[model samples]
Target: MDKALPRTIACVTAVLGLALALAGPAAATPGVPAPEASADGTLVSRTGTAVTVTAAVGLSNTISVWQAGDTIRVRDTGDTVTALGGCRPVSANEAVCPGAGSLTELVVHAGDQADDVTSFLESLGVTLVGGAGDDSLYGGGANDTLEGDEGADFLSGGGGNDTLTGSSGRDRLFGGPGNDSIEGRGGGDLINAGAGNDVVSGGNGNDQVIAGTGNDFVDGGPGQDTLDAVDEVGGNDYVRGGDESDTCRADLGDSVTECP
Candidate 1:
């Protein structure tokens, strides 16, 4: 019995040693490396240390490979770029962007050309300023201010209390919600006050103004114009036709008085 026990113990010890030897190399070896992640947009060109990213039209993208002292160029191809992060405009065509991971404030500036611009908002606020050329701007959620400085423009305030100004040329303006203020500074313009109580003025040219929903104050400034404020059910609106011979339609309990 003693001889049989010695044989059994030796056989068990030999098996354990073989198993440990077989498992040692695998336990000591390093794991396989993870696949590298690619940047968001198409890498159009890489010259020396500078990289140019051509984001798909109407789509916004971020490149993570940008390091300090690296020049990053973005090409939007006539589409408006809404920055979800920090971006400062160096020129009408270029900008200094924030880091890829920091998706913070939305900083947006219009491009050089006169083109249509669209913006959407989440919980964060947005600011959109137009360029020298004719631009069409849409403000989607936040309390936004849409300013059309130079040429003929179209500005729409989607939600929030917004300020829309058409500085020059023939323009179109629409106010979506909350309390809004709209001004068409020059050329013949069309203005619509969508939901809340609003103050609207057609600055120059032969303009048309429509006050939709809430109590509104509308002024047709200068040229021959048309004003309509009959849309609100329980709203009291004031329509003043300024300067030239103007035609105005008012809601029940509303007032229409010609300017001196």
Candidate 2:
């Protein structure tokens, strides 16, 4: 895309040094397409033989690695060099185009399994946003936002004020710290308010919640549900209802507990 990405991404790439060298050149396979960058991000043709992303140019860029047949495309606004073959590893100190372009570094990946996405962000200590898939360890950083679209998913609010939402299917949410909100649209769900003021709501099926500390609010929107609050200066904790009977627990220190 022509629009510039946040400078923080570039800083992250530089600090983490997650850049790799472009793959070596090879004869074009008949149905294979070359990796190309687009406004949305990098689009790799499914038929591509290999895809390599040089850290120097693609650090600040969010490259969407996709496949089309045997081709792979890398679309972005940042500067890039292509080899039209397969990707390979390069040393951090390796020099290339000293004057024309600067170098960017990235941490090494330890696992042998295919871990392009996870290894990339883990190198930078930046959390990867979950797409339309089953995600377990989701959410990180201050005010992190986790969205699960389709399929069963799991979201965790690592720290600070966070928001977690599940669009469909069975979901699990954990509010780790600060004020947080967890919303589940469909299917049975489990929610945990780890700390701070938190709010949790379930859409359908059976649901369970463990509200940890501070003033908390929990709502079991449908089916049978259960709620818990251990011990605290528990004051007016709101528990909204939908259909069907629900069970609620009051801690020894509850000042004002409301359930319906």
Candidate 3:
């Protein structure tokens, strides 16, 4: 009876070991993992034409702010964030940052009192319908379009594919890069199309046009004017000194003569 009892106990122990092995490893605790630390933080505010952006402690280095149309964009390298100042979320890493009433398009009508307007944020689009007084318009950095109608205006396209039109004033137009179009209509104007493929025209006034780099088309219409299509590498450009006696200069023997 003692030997039989020992054999029975051994068999039971072996069976228990087999069942334990069949039950697989214990399941891990069922819960979500903790999130990582955020990399950027930002705050935005505005007063009149001036807009301010402040970054959180330790996150100032990683945050960048820019303007697109009427909306400002705040970017963070870390986690996604909600909108601020009525700005819409652009992506997980970016949000539109605006101060109070943000504008997607800023238009200045004729007879308005404002003379100088500037866009602090990069990429904001602005349009000026000139009054009798002279005006100055600046497009910081982004694809911007500016029009000067009437007064002798100064328009600058900081960066991007900017389109600037000066109508009826002795204006100065500058196109920064990324393919630009500049036109001076009815007054003596100065135009510089800097880099990228550009189209520049001086209508009716004694104008000076410089096509800087890339393929360009330049026209000096009416009065005596100067057209320069010369670059370091002598770009491929089509230049026409229209109407009255004009001077046309080109590099690498690139052909530029009288208007067709």
Per-model lDDT: 0.60, 0.47, 0.60
Model 1 lDDT per residue over 1-260, tens place:
56555654553444334334432432332222212212332223333322223333223222221223423333343432323233444443344554422323333345334655565543334445555577777886767667777688888988987778787688889988867778887899989989887778788899999988776777799999999888745226667899999988875445567943
Q: Which candidate has the top score in TM-score?
A: 1
Show where candidate 3 strays beyond 4 Å.
1-114
* Residue 112 C-alpha lDDT in model 3: 25
Q: Taking the tens digit of each residue's C-alpha lDDT, what string does model 3 give over 9-73? A: 45334433432332222111111221222233433333455433333333212334455554566
Question: Which residue runs does candidate 2 get wrong by more than 4 Å?
Answer: 1-129, 252-260
TM-score of candidate 1 against the unseen true structure: 0.61
What TM-score goes with each of the models?
0.61, 0.51, 0.59
- CA RMSD per model (angstroms): 29.1, 17.5, 29.5
Report how far off residue 155 is in candidate 2 (Å): 0.8
**Backbone collision tally, model 2:** 33
